[model samples]
Target: MKSAVEILSALAEPTRLAAMRLLWDGREHCVCELMRELGASQSRMSRHMSVLRNAGLVVDRRDAQWVRYRIAPDLSAETFALLEAALALSGKPQRVAA
Candidate 1:
């Protein structure tokens, strides 16, 4: 399990932070969706998701050749609140990219 410090540190990267913000809607997003929305290459997006996964902030499942991810549903209330606070403090409106 990742420590709280590790999780917070993961969010410090802009790509990971933006990805988390996109996933904050509490819905599943396919890798392709995230790539297109974030303008990230497949490998780059995968790397960012890996960090988020390691932090326990997100969960993913494979769908044939694709993968889908979402904010982890099993996060403790306290951890969830921390994520909520981080997103709130980001100062960016939550919306899917064009």
Candidate 2:
């Protein structure tokens, strides 16, 4: 289980919230796509990613040189629900990428 501080910290930033929303459907996303979508610098985006990873709200897998990130599978029910709610309000429409 994650602590309150971890959860709060993970949900603290707009970018991180958007990242979580993007990952809500259990899809893995390449870092570059996230950068493009978020219009954020690589370093800035990476810091947000690191925070979420540390809070256990997200997870990453390496595919050769690239790392893909998604919402962690083992998230607690409450946390998952909270994330789901947040996703509902995250403004971006669902987009399918080839």
Candidate 3:
């Protein structure tokens, strides 16, 4: 498991933190969808996602030309608790229409 600092570092970025909130509802979100919703360019979004992925804060899978993201489901209780607290401080993320 990653240290607390690493995980916190991942979420420290505004873009990555927002992306996590979008995935908080447990829905798989495509990179393009996130890009559109977050107003990020493709390369920029991918880079942010890579940081989250590397920290094990998120996971992804390929779907044709797109990649999907979601919060990592296998987090330890401790990590989840920490994240919950951090997110609580950030307020609610805007909802994306289905």
Candidate 4:
């Protein structure tokens, strides 16, 4: 059983939540694009991405040197609803600041 704390912790950070919003808006985003928009170091963004991935809330696919991350489609209904509602609350703003 997944801990609620673990899931909430992964969503707690503003940057991580923003990243999810971005992906939720675009469906997928390459690492460079994420870094540019989030103004976060590659390693930093990757760390959050890894956390999301580990929580089974996100999915990634590699295309050449680019890796794209997005909300995972295979999650349980509960998580999917949570993510959808969170993203909805996050709203559809333009690309984030660099």
Question: Which number leads on TM-score?
Answer: 3
- For TM-score, candidate 3 versus 4, the one ahead is 3
lDDT of 1 at 12: 85
Per-model root-mean-square deviation over C-alphas: 3.5, 3.4, 3.1, 4.7
Q: After superposition, how far is residue 80 of candidate 4 from its true place, in Å?
A: 1.5
Residue-by-residue lDDT tens digits, candidate 1, 1-98: 56678878988898898898888877899999999999999999999999999989999999999999999889877777667777778975654432
User: What's the TM for model 4?
Assistant: 0.80
TM-scores for candidates 1 onward, in order: 0.88, 0.82, 0.91, 0.80
lDDT of each: 0.86, 0.80, 0.88, 0.79
The true-versus-predicted C-alpha distance at residue 61 of model 4, in Å, is 1.3
Task: Give the runs in model 2 whose Cα sits over 4 Å from its true position.
Answer: 89-98
The sequence of per-residue lDDT tens digits that candidate 4 reaches over residues 1-98 is 24667777788788989888787754678989999999999999999899999888888999998889876767776776666666667674453432
Ranking by TM-score: 3, 1, 2, 4
TM-score of 1: 0.88
Task: Please give, for residues 1-98, the per-residue lDDT of candidate 2 as tens digits.
Answer: 88866787788799999887777666899888789999999888889999999988899988886678988889888877666665566664453431
The Cα error of candidate 3 at residue 78, in Å, is 1.1
**Model 3 lDDT vs. the true structure?**
0.88
Alpha-carbon lDDT of model 4: 0.79
Please give the TM-score that candidate 2 achieves against the real structure: 0.82
